[model samples]
Target: MDFSFGPEDERFRAQARAWLAAHLVGPYAGLKGRGGPGSEHEGAEDRRGWERELGADGWIGLGWDRAHGGYGNRGATLTQQVVWAEEYARAQAPGRVGHIGENLLAPTLLAYGSPAQRDRFLPPIARGEELWCQGYSEPEAGSDLAGIRTAATLDAGDSGYRITGQKIWTSLAHEADWCFVLARTEAGSRRHHGLSFLLVPMDQPGRIEVRPIRQLSGTSEFNEVFFDGAAARAEHVVGGAGGGWQVAMGLLALERGVSTLVQQIGFASELGEVVRVALRTGAADEPTVRDRLVRQWAELQSMRWNALRTLGAQSGTGGQGRPGGADPGAASVAKLLWGGWHQRLGELAMQVRGAPAAVGPYDWSADRPYELDALQRLFLFTRADTIYGGSDEIQRTIIAERVLGLPKGARPST
Candidate 1:
């Protein structure tokens, strides 16, 4: 129903808009249109400044508890979070330095971590002081996360475990000071039940190495990580041993929710850019281009509203990780729709630009100089949207088994 924000919510939205207007100057005005603040070395101060700026304003962790350097959940409505995501998209602020930390790890810590763990990790993450990365997707384990081979052996003295393994596709590993990783704690035990989650420091002397991966767009953002004889203190473990499957599932729920909402909002700005470019180049008048743009706008609006409904329902009823709960399956639907739409929009953009879209990568400043690099990169990257964060096939399976009560599929013997 009523999609409109009530009086108090509207007031909060107005306040946020005003604050963002004053503090955020050029380039940061549109969330999706703007990119990350330079590379690791170049962005250090800007990243810190943005983090501290948001942290000081109490906007860094929208759902975090107040006692831990956050504004605290404070009965914060999901609508508020959605508004923040959408508005921040409009604001074009630099993306989070520790996305894995803030979105996945922080939530898990709050839900299942010890009080000490919470105190140790949450504040710096909120303040942007300590960046974190994820060590989940290994060379052997990407979509089949249950198939991870990284192991942690318990110490003989009843102390911490020794970790040695390699992780690939680790986004931001080189810049991260910390990582939330999954390791097989039990030998000869297979499946998801034998795993454990560890909070690891990246700056340690031995047992770890970080090598950045260059993307097709020439960005060294993701990395390959190796850990040898690394020690993880017992207290760093979240949940119990053998309970990592459950924790991983919960973390996936967090990932799906955050990605579906924040990312869709972010993608909307790109669509807007497409429209602006078309209008600037006189291509907006073409019948087919006009129809596609209109279709995209409609699809985006529909998807965003559906996401809002899911958020409101989850917030009011509290069924994020419960069986027969609202279920995180809503995220799958969002991802499928948004991912497909993004891919299509990129195609349409290229078509509209025609030969001009093939030009060499020029700086975005020159008039009529189409930044084909950005368009090409998006077109290329959006091809993987349905594959990463659980593939489209996986999402359909989730809907079939969990949401539709389909019979479980049998697995092959290894």
Candidate 2:
């Protein structure tokens, strides 16, 4: 596949950059999160507001059709989206607040959800009116997802099931209006067979409880959700009964393929921020820090290439499943490489900051909060990069068996 963006893509980039220059101004110009550079900065509302603006302008769902509340620009190819990712990477756009909606749920709905389901969910999500969070990782089922104990039994006579189970490590549940969950409906089937995907409301219910989980950065980035006989709609069912595995796999494809792109770009931007700090503080003069920064930059580029390849595949340009497409092995490789890159970058950033990296928020000037807080938070979060998206060991095993065509190991005893 052609890696270079032709004249068409270059024009798209120009238009996007120009529009961003005009609209992303004043308070909304800065990055999100703790220790950001500016005191007058954008908040979640600002991010949502910008999303609404993108939606209104048809820039929000850059890849989706116009009828589905997107900008309906068919001119932009998957390459153009990659270009958009690049430009946004340069501008330091907010790392998607409704990632579940935009990346995982939206695409899944487009592919699997009914027209009514699409009509109800897509527009609100595109408009930033409804936020979504994933409800996949349960207490007993992280990597071994088929072991999910969450039950969504059919009710006597109704629109939905009586869902009762606990989902842990649910990201952004605090702000989400809906959750795409995986629950078991069949009792006799093996790990991957008896599951179904459910779209659940967070507020209404049998009993909805959300408890925030603190990260190493001392921030509550994820939550634990407890559901007790939550009423869901039959329409919310993504795939047929005992098909949750397929639906969940598709969602994971979105997770590892599309959603991962947004995050990897965001992380790459953070790596760039490290360079900016190095330049600002004269840390680049240090050979160690300079070499580390250079390596991180190279890794970021490699990841971008991989992401482009995935997008190209999605656009039907290449192999059956792009590297990081639906294949678990491919996703595992992407996750492993991405996690390593992020962790190394964080370490390098802290090293560049030296003693100041450990200093609390109070030690830094308010103007430099972006660097300070990012360094702190990134340092904390990077530790889990290997664990959250599936452990590094699992990734290696996938690569060995699937990618390398190695002999399969004996199945682990449950």
What candidate 2 gets wrong by more than 4 Å, as runs, is: 26-42, 65-75, 279-283, 317-328, 361-372, 407-414
RMSD of candidate 1 to the truth, in angstroms, is 3.9
Find the candidate with the highest TM-score and give its number.
Answer: 1
Model 1 worst lDDT window (10 residues):
316-325
- Residue-level lDDT of model 1, residues 1-414, one tens digit each, is 576778777777887788787877543333323444123333544565666677677676676645443425343456666677767667766676656777788877776777888889877777767888888887767777888899999999858988999998787787788888899998988878689998888887778999888765556767899999888888888887777777777777666554467777766777887888889888898998999999999998898777767655655434223321466477677668876888798787777677777666555666544333666666656666677667788778778888898997875342
Residue 230 of model 1 has an lDDT of 83
Q: Cα lDDT of all candidates, in order? A: 0.72, 0.72
lDDT of 2 by residue, 1-414 (tens): 788889989999998888777777776676433222111123756776666766666565566645443423343567677777677766766656666787778777766777788878887876767888898888878876767888888877756787889999887787788998898876665678788888889987448899987666656667899998887887788876777877777667667654566667677667778888889888999897788888888888888778766666565622122223444465676788888988887788888787888876543556553433657767777888778867787779878987889998876443
